[model samples]
Target: MSYSPTIYKFADGGGAPVAPEMALVRAVLEPHDVGDPQLTVGEDGSLRFWIRASDDSEAEISADETGILVERPQTGGVFAIVAELVTKLGAVIIDPASGRAVCRAEEQTRLPADMREEAIVIDMTGDALEAALLGPRIAVGPSPRAAR
Candidate 1:
């Protein structure tokens, strides 16, 4: 008998496609521990585009120490958004601000230069998460047992 892996991509209601701002907020804040001086995600989409953080395990985070807990925004995209947020907020300060500090992929610069430090700055501990959510991630295959 022969078996072959298959790939499938699909979208869902998924509790309403989180708004761009909210998605960015989620991507930005979902990477820190509780009460870790970081913002959090709220239920009511009142102001989705605020900021937040998390503190997952080493294996569960990106190199930049972001999230791998509750999946939402695309890993790389999330990381880009967060990195950009960090850069904007002066978190990962890169005096040069070149190379990985900023990528030349996204159309409009991911993070702006006016991101308020008060808006960002959470305690998302770990590097995997940072890598997974705030580093350079590339889209790959879909899950074999996804709820699509």
Candidate 2:
């Protein structure tokens, strides 16, 4: 069967779409553990992540200036990560095919098993998170997940 991409985006902050800010990016990714193909965010405001399901299906995530696009999200981990980040960033999960918000920010969505233990949802203020990002050691824990 064919599959559609899933998108995670910020609710219109103004009259326009908003991309994720650095702190939001850090908050969402720093404590996340995606195993081998960990999510990578570029200094230029780009992101890339690949997900491989237990069923052997694979998906790729791409980001534009507006939001994150998950291509062919065949795994629950895909939504798990999205749910985590959506809650953290105050964003929402968009069903690309329908162009609707399936999951709203801060809503209690369940995490998939593969991600339940690995995912560490953040509760830091922007100033605190920024501080942790700059310091020799992070307050959250070990250094934020390697971007590489």
Question: How does each model score on TM-score?
Answer: 0.21, 0.49
Task: Give the poorly placed runs of model 1, Cα more than 4 Å off.
Answer: 1-46, 50-71, 92-148
Q: Model 2, 60: alpha-carbon shift in Å?
A: 1.3
Model 2, global lDDT: 0.47
| Alpha-carbon RMSD, each predicted model | 17.5, 15.2
Q: Model 2: per-residue lDDT, tens digit, 94-138?
A: 444444344332321333333234332344332222222222333
* Candidate 1 worst ten-residue window by lDDT: 2-11
Per-residue lDDT tens digits for candidate 1, residues 1-148, read 2111111111131211112333443454454323333224334432222223332221112221221122233323334344454333323322121212222223113334332221223343333324423453466787877847
Query: What is the TM-score of candidate 1?
Result: 0.21
Per-residue error at 99 for model 1, in Å?
27
Each candidate structure's count of clashing pairs: 30, 0
> Clashing residue pairs in candidate 2, if any?
none
